[model samples]
Target chain A: MSDAKFHLYYWPGLPGRGEFVRLVLEEAGADWVDVGLLPESQGGGARAMMEALGQGAVPAYAPPVLKVGDLEIAQAPNICSYLGERFGLVPPDEAARLHARQFQLTVADVVAEAHDTHHPIAVMKTYEEQKEPAKAHAEVFRTQRIPKYLGYFERVLKANTRGGGRYLIGSDFSYPELGLFQIVEGLLYAFPNAMRRIASQVPGVMALRERIAERPRIAAYKSSKRAQPFNPKGIFRHYAELDEPNAMK
Target chain B: MSDAKFHLYYWPGLPGRGEFVRLVLEEAGADWVDVGLLPESQGGGARAMMEALGQGAVPAYAPPVLKVGDLEIAQAPNICSYLGERFGLVPPDEAARLHARQFQLTVADVVAEAHDTHHPIAVMKTYEEQKEPAKAHAEVFRTQRIPKYLGYFERVLKANTRGGGRYLIGSDFSYPELGLFQIVEGLLYAFPNAMRRIASQVPGVMALRERIAERPRIAAYKSSKRAQPFNPKGIFRHYAELDEPNAMK
Candidate 1:
């Protein structure tokens, strides 16, 4: 079953956006190839990823594309939803599936905001060139966006009629939950000071994060060498000046 | 046919994110009610929109939620996809549908970036409060992001074996094309200065915009009073200082 594993094309050396996809793949115990991990000569690494992205007829707007058999697609939520359907990780009900996608998309929103805090101008520009604006962006992300988004999820968790708030959608541990886990992990890494304040209010979300971490496979994956560390180069970077909550005023 | 229309929940006065949903509904010729347009007593206006959003069991994280019978979903792209399926505006093939979704999500990404140019620090804060950072954010958006995204879409259009670049997906029209139209419209409104510069290089995207605008249904919708004018309060706002492409150092 694992013989013809799915191929994941992403930039190497940082989890970045690809971490969301990696979480779902690792948790499902699915056989997949992280193209970045393969040898450069074997059509791997950043150059291979960029070449594949550039050549696609449909043209994905960015990386972290999943190629399964003949169908290749980008966008983390779209990929997760597809994988969820394939692996029985989504809600069985029709409406529930859409709700799961909403949650996944919202997670993507938060991730993008987090990324923008360090690169308020553009990703193409160096953070050093944009630190002043980054300072302002980080403050708002820390104070407003984080709580608004995370708190909404907390409410959703509390309101869940199924899974008793442990899962995002129904009673099942769905892929969106893995997304939430990653959001929590990244926020903790990027905005520890702000997340510390938010942590007390979003106990449900924190608990969900802890539970996902303890899952046997997830625990093993996180401890394994394949799991990448949160680095400054990635979406969730921790600049001491930007991470401080009171700097905006 | 227009009697029992789908209900749209969004803030009044500005098209905002709701415009994306509105374009699809209008082009599909689906009868729909803009709840924000109704009187406060009859469950219209901003209060009504907020209350309806609060009451949903599924809990939409933001507005532009669509209520079709008992199924209410938020997230503009999600709503558009749902409407796309209902109105026969989506690609019939599974892979193509996912590809359409990828395009829709990328459009969402560009919209978010555009919005951040005005509200770089926080949406909770006023434009005045964040004006300094916004000027900086907007500069990079003008010089880099606007071209990168529009250029990418131009390539997607050129690569399209379907619709001969007239439609985003296959030979027929899809919801994502409507989304692309809205993006172009909003960009033209918000950053007329920058858009004028990039317009020359993205002829395919520009041509697609013209074709969608000329469609009989869409043309009628634009002339009708139901079509709201672009205002400063929406996702795409025109701040003179922020719109100048050459302002950043």
Candidate 2:
């Protein structure tokens, strides 16, 4: 693999979307730097992220952008796919690669929906202002969306005739499994009640999440300081009111 | 291109995410069939889509799935990217292809947010059930999300020194431009008031939309019976109450 150092620019807080990117890097054992986590004197932090965003001739729509030499890539799935290709984290076959990307995109969809549970109306507005709607949004998320998405991944795992259904795409532990790991971890953090209730329904997915965590590198990364702990400020916030099961009932 | 005929299976009525796939097929002049629109006797319609979904070893999570030979691909952008690789609708260079996928994924983000405005609380519940929340959600979408996403596209266009800002990725129109075309069309249909107000700020994006419409094949397809009209039942729905500007204010 190329020894080119990769620079990841994301908000210096909770894992958020960057965790997906970080998982891929850490799993692949790639040499990368989290710019936001570094000291300002070292040309990092929120200011560094903002500077990279503005400095790029093509400004990133948002952070969690990956900078590789002169080219800066945005979007979490896109970055993962790029790293997957370079580090052989995806399947060798084209169709399998496409499927891997498709699953990753689906994972992105679930992540966005999960984030919206807390900020249902306006992300710019305080959660306090949107509390009522967030309650409603989180209800559906915990009930319908969680099952639909996790169930889909469950089906994906069961249907894969490769690797005894341990992988999401091909017969291997691709970049997307790392993504699945993040999604499962985020859900557990955000909605422990719902996730606990829903976990049994998606044994394959839960197993895969455990499998990813058990990987030597992943296990090391999780215990390391680099693996940021989940907080309320991130996408999957643990708002007690929003995490209630069957709130409408 | 290969003499393979593509079968696209989506919900029969709504453009929804399928339109992104449809636009690519239309613009590329690919021989494809809309499985949901065909006669049931001929192995088509919603039943056909359901059968296809069930038939896949790994069942599709949702619709707008493309069937080429034996492989059934789901997710709009994934289908487009696959076709793009074969039809030369994407840049020949690897980095550019990755970037096009990036832009397409961002478009997916915008589309998802736009959809969430109308179904902020519950997808399974009726729009009326979530009407109050939808109004609040749409207000933020109109005032903030529309500009933020469109502005991002505008920045992408401006940064592309290759085509003088005519295309999103490369000097030539790519698959993402087709996706962009569909997004602009959907926004204009669903949020005419907000779009009219926001259009001036993202002239680059608007112009690109117009440019895509002006494409010979796309123009022909627009007038063709196959070009489905926008409806309230789709992702970009126009509920009168939901379209009110700054409703919270």
Candidate 3:
């Protein structure tokens, strides 16, 4: 039932944008392939990516674009929502589904802000060139924005009616765990102090991350070459300068 | 049916973020009032804003949040989708509804990018201070991103099987138009030279904008004081330095 014809086109070296999709398919136990991680698959990578983007349609510029047969969707949340539907991970009700997507978009927004913590001024400029602004902005984000988002997500999780599964769908294996864990892990990696102090309050979310990390597929993938080691090149790059010691707390 | 219990809270000045929700409600012909518009209504502005933001929600960071009796929702697209559902602007099917949401989110991505054209470096900095960076980024966005987003949207509209409507929903006013046209209008105001050329090729989208502009609620809103005239302080600021006449196609 999981033999999916999905091709996720992302860069080979970075646990980049596409990792969210990869982690999800792994959790769903779906049959999908990483299009570019293997050298021999790079051409297919470009094809899957460009087609999903559409000819003369608009270059996605960045990777982690996904293809479900003929559709070439680019945005991460867009891909996640599509897969959620095809994989039966979305809520049964329309409003619930909208909320799921809204939550996903919020997560994506958090991730983007995390990226900017490292690259604040110009996406094209080096961290050294933008260090001052990056530091100032990261301070604002970590102290003010981070807690706001985390607290809100915690509230939403508490509102979830799922009794014990600890998933966003609680009892259901959903990508919220993957997204939340990625966020937590990224924050832990990038803004350790702030995330650590505040994270203890969101026990359910933290527990879900630990739980997902123990999932067989994710655990196996984590050990494989398929999982790109987190480095400065990815969305959640660790910059010691930005993550001050007391910033997270 | 249109006159229900919808309260919209946005900045009292510029149409800004509130315009997205305003346009959708108008296009849907929903019964909603622009809260916080008068002197005595000052406090309602504060209350209307706080609640529409899904009280205690992190995303409630800004205006244009919507409040029904009890549910307060924030984020531009979230509010639009909620209204789109009640107004029949969204499709009955979950897939189509999600698709509509995907389209709406894309519009939002572009809107943010458009905003960045003027404030690429720091949100707190004056436009003049960021003028050089803004000019450079705007060049890339105008030549590259504007075409990319417009083309993607045009293709989505063209691919619509429910075709033959002057709107994204095909024959109806979907809120995407309100958002996209806002993008178009902002880009045009901000980058006249680039739009003069790009708008020519995007006839379908242009037509849709024209159609939406003709909707009585929207037309009246645009003519009334409610439609804040585009100014330098809003998301889509018009800066001469940022838009060099020589840079356009």
Clashes of each: 0, 0, 8
lDDT of each: 0.85, 0.86, 0.70
Q: Which candidate ranks first by lDDT, i.e. highest?
A: 2
Q: In every candidate, what fraction of the native interface contacts is reproduced?
A: 0.71, 0.82, 0.07
Predicted candidate 2 versus true structure: per-residue lDDT over A143-223, tens digit per residue: 889998999888888888876878887677888899988999999999988888899999999999988999999999999
lDDT of 2 by residue, B1-249 (tens): 124489998988889899899988988889988888888888778888877775786578888899888788888888888887789988788777878888888888888988888888888888888888888888888888889888988988888888798878767888889888889998998988788788899999999998899999999988988888999889998876766554234
Task: Please name the candidate that would achieve the greatest DockQ relative to the true structure.
Answer: 2
CA lDDT, candidate 3, residue B234: 81
Model 3 Cα interface RMS deviation (Å): 4.8
Candidate 1 stretches greater than 4 Å from native? A1-3, A245-249, B1-5, B245-249
Q: Candidate 3 on A1-249: residue-level lDDT in tens?
A: 123587777766677667778887776777787776534544444455445454422234356666665455566776776677667776666545655666777787788778867665456667787676677668777777778777777666666556352556544666656777778777887887777777777777778778878889889988887787778888887887777687434
For candidate 3, give fnat to 2 decimals: 0.07
TM-score of chain B of 3: 0.87
Task: Please report the TM-score between candidate 1 and the true structure.
Answer: 0.95
Candidate 1 lDDT over B1-249, as tens digits, reads 124569999988888889888988888888788989988777788888888776776788899788877777888888888788778888678888898889999999989998988888777878888887788788889888899999999988888776687667777778899889889999999998888888999999998899889999899988989888888888898877877653233
